[model samples]
Target chain A: MKQLTELHAMVSKAVDELTFPAYPTDLYEPISYILSLGGKRLRPALLLMACDLFGGDVEKAIEPALAIEVFHNFTLMHDDIMDKAPLRRGKITVHEKWNANVAILSGDAMMVEANKFMMKVDDAILRRVMDVFNETATGVCEGQQIDMSFEQRNNVLIDEYLDMIRLKTAVLLGGTLKIGAIIGGATSTDAQLLYSFGVNLGIAFQLQDDILDVYGDPEKFGKQVGGDILSNKKTYLLIKALELANGDDANMLDHWLSVEQFNATEKVAAVTGVYDRLDIRNYAEDAMQTYADAAFNALDQIDLSEDRRQYLRQFADNLLVREY
Target chain B: MKQLTELHAMVSKAVDELTFPAYPTDLYEPISYILSLGGKRLRPALLLMACDLFGGDVEKAIEPALAIEVFHNFTLMHDDIMDKAPLRRGKITVHEKWNANVAILSGDAMMVEANKFMMKVDDAILRRVMDVFNETATGVCEGQQIDMSFEQRNNVLIDEYLDMIRLKTAVLLGGTLKIGAIIGGATSTDAQLLYSFGVNLGIAFQLQDDILDVYGDPEKFGKQVGGDILSNKKTYLLIKALELANGDDANMLDHWLSVEQFNATEKVAAVTGVYDRLDIRNYAEDAMQTYADAAFNALDQIDLSEDRRQYLRQFADNLLVREY
Candidate 1:
């Protein structure tokens, strides 16, 4: 709990320190605007905590910690432009606010800034850090590419979806955590363990998000509940429902899916019915907890002390067991 | 000439070595496709020559040398996507070939690969190389922003234009050469001198491109001539025309600028007359020479054998005086 406070305070400071230099006009102000319209600063905080837990100086880790977030935001800005998403975290996406051209250029500048920030990390760990960052960044792109490919396909298997999310979302956590542990003077083996832990946690976290997308209460979800069902987007429960639905329930699922126009409320009710008949909710829950358990196993394998590990585990558990 | 051969060979080898593991199918193939459609290996060759002139091992500097060109191409790829350009060097741009989504994602991967290649340099010089690279990359984005801003501005001075080109086009040349010299074991001061040399050469090179854009013979030019004039696209000549045209010529220029439709050839001819009356070509030539002189002056100040410096100077002269 105290370490979570430490994380909160450090993440706040890191976020606050990120401001754009005044340009001739408000040209680069979007860079600051997106970072200021904040989200959960979880990746960078995980990196900082991993560094501290591994006995590295947290101060030295802050720059790269910040680098990871800038890199993340840069990806978001560009991806939003490509996806034509209008909003992020209930705020205007960068492209929506300043047009796509500015969003693309500003996002490019932000990525460059992220690399510049990473270079500010001391040379002792710079090469290793760059290597890890490079792999993670590339993985993130690969993940995005895979996700886009899935849009054109109908029968995306559970394994394929898992791999896509791992690349798109999970490896960043592992990469950030490993960079911290490595910079903090962990041996190669310890760094690998930490990376695996973060990765498994990422997989579990994404599965949790998918479950919440359908089953969670609409008012408490803060965003759309069953939004994916309306869009006919492939998530775990839908793929499982397609796989497990028996005769007439399958026919009912097909009827809704085959429609030309979407009705969100009706779709949500129908899909929840299919999920209940097949007990797909429990299947998804069991699957998510398996990964969460695997993540804990990976964490336990690391050489970190119980106190340090306990805080991380508790934080992760709190994230997993949330109602909405 | 022998140095050019060595560089040409190295570039050929470097291009061949670009391989990303192909499992994810969508994520990395775009990068390989983009890099494989090669153009003139000008930037990397210049880097190798700069190193060889300063007596650095060409083998050791090859990856980092190639990094400059790779980084350059990465910019071209992303910029083309943003510009909605149809082709690059007569090849379909990555975005055009495989959609904007693939282009955007692959471009991100290429930028990371560029950093990975640079970090492969010796540990002692990695810090400085990254510092220069990070700075140059950010400068490039800033220059691009300014260039886009110019499209909306009615009055951009020649000095401001030069500065824009400095950030947009020249700093990376300086960065490439500086990294080459440092890897070759040039003293810090010698590296700075090499950067100056590259900067001056780059300015001249760009002015020459502007010159060729306006006046080169059609067959030898390899593209449309006076295209800048036809579009009323601001170039050095057009800016000078705005500053220097008198009476009837001024009115004609303004009319052409306002006219949305005209014969492209007639527009070219009309602008050519304005350029002749204003003697804009000669003024631009003198300006080009001034910067070329500055580059040579910096080369003269470098502490190297006169014979060795001759090759580097000649290499630059070859570029400055290109026909096609």
Candidate 2:
């Protein structure tokens, strides 16, 4: 547990130390600027934590962990530019802070640097790391693509959405933990179990995210509460509403989604009303719990000493039950 | 030689046939679109050539070759977005055809797919390939960042510019060839030498490109001749021009770069005038030859059969001497 805390500190320190060469000064400023806008170094931290749980040298893993973080942020920087996202972590995005072109170029460099840093890992684990990285990277892209494609689709089924999140969100969480486990010399089966645990927790986290978006305390929620509701984002609750809607319920849901402009509060209230009628919140919760239970089950299946397993399980439990 | 040609064909066919799963249908459309745009397929094809040159199965090498090609095109898509000069091979840039966001995401996916494809290689070769791939990927990014950094500077030296291009343009070419050689079962020393050959050739290729951008025949060049001239890009000629300019020459060069509204012909004529004053074009020609000679030297130094080396050298020679 103490090691996990120390590993977290190391990830933060590594993030602070990274700098892109400044010769063609314009190209790398965005790299610095984007990284400066902080998010939880969760993926890398998870990797470090997984390493520590198995008594691996945390120092040996930090560079690779940092590589994962840089790679993740690089995607976000470019993704923001692509999504025309105005803010990240409540700050103006890199593209917004700078411009789209700079963000795109710097982001490309960041990804390259990510691979460069991963090269620091020992050769013994290189292929295993790279192979998993390839799949994780591909999965993230697939998830994003699926997430975007939903915008045009009339029928984004619950299962399809689950798969999308699996690709986009869960796979990386799974992969990161699994990478850490593998690096720490976990058996392949143990790595699989760890990965499944992280991935299932990730889904629960996302589903909780959807719930909190509508029902959260605004101050605790950080950003605009009910943003997903207002934006008509195809979150689990909304998607389930679409699936469960009948008679007047269907009509109201369509009207709300189709409404080009409305008061934000009214939109939130209307959507919440529909959710209440169908108890979509419970549906989302049940679905979320199903995955969360799966994650715990996965953790239980791991062959680590029970104490190590419990620590990992406790973290997952905390992650699922968090308010923010 | 015939087998070499078959190797090239087989790698090309595999690259052409390689398809990534479309989880987010829109995410990778840009990749397919750009891959569809078609270039010489030189990088992957070179890998195959190197493989057979080393007496390795072209079949076993094909996926890794495709991986390299996929990587090459990913760089192009992202680079095109950064450079913002439309029309790669006379087609609209990915950002132009789709949005910047899609190009960025798809490009990321392409890079991931490249790694995924490489992971499928025999485990024996897979580790070394990933190491080379990591090195090349980082080198490419470093080169690009340096190139970008150079854009904002006034006193960039010729050697520094050469270094930048070596990172930006040459390393991947070297890397591509080395991967092929490695996969093809070339010895470590030979692979190292092959990498140098490819890198040196890449540097020469870029220098030739700079020359052709200003001087190539319009139709044969397949681009807007003098495009770099108009952009005030920091090419070898421009870097040399900055170093060599004196009296009125320096003033004229500065004025030309600062001018917002010069006719294309006027801009080209003025830039060419500066190039002539310092014999910058001749300096560039000499520099290009230096690199080309180095490439040939590397090729000659390899332990592989001279007859085998001859055809590849001949192909590269045609490139070095081409007017367009």
Lowest summed-lDDT stretch of 10 residues in model 2 chain B?
B1-10
**TM-scores across all candidates?**
0.96, 0.91
In terms of lDDT, the poorest run of 10 residues in model 1 chain B is B1-10
List where candidate 2 sits over 4 angstroms from the true fold.
Answer: A1-3, A17-29, A54-59, A219-224, B1-5, B149-156, B217-227, B230-233, B246-274
**Candidate 2 C-alpha lDDT tens digits along B191-236:** 9999999999999999988888877788887778889999899999
TM (chain A) per model: 0.94, 0.96
lDDT string, candidate 1, B1-324, tens digits: 246877878777888787888957766787777778888777887778777777778888889977887788888888897678998888888888888877777777788888888888899988988888888898888888888888888688999888888888999899888988888889989999999998888888888888899888778878789877876778888888888988999998888989998999898989889889999999999999999999999999999987888878887888888775
lDDT of 2 by residue, A185-211 (tens): 788898889899989999999999999
Among all candidates shown, the one with the greatest TM-score? 1
lDDT of 1 by residue, A1-324 (tens): 237568758976888777776863434798888888788888888888888887788888788888988999999998998899999888999878878778877888889888887777777778888888889988898888888888888788888888988999999999999998887889889899889988888988888888898888767766688888887778888888888877999998888888978667887898888989999889888889888998899888888778888877887898787766
- lDDT values of the candidates? 0.84, 0.84
In terms of lDDT, which candidate is strongest?
1
Reference-based TM-score, model 2: 0.91
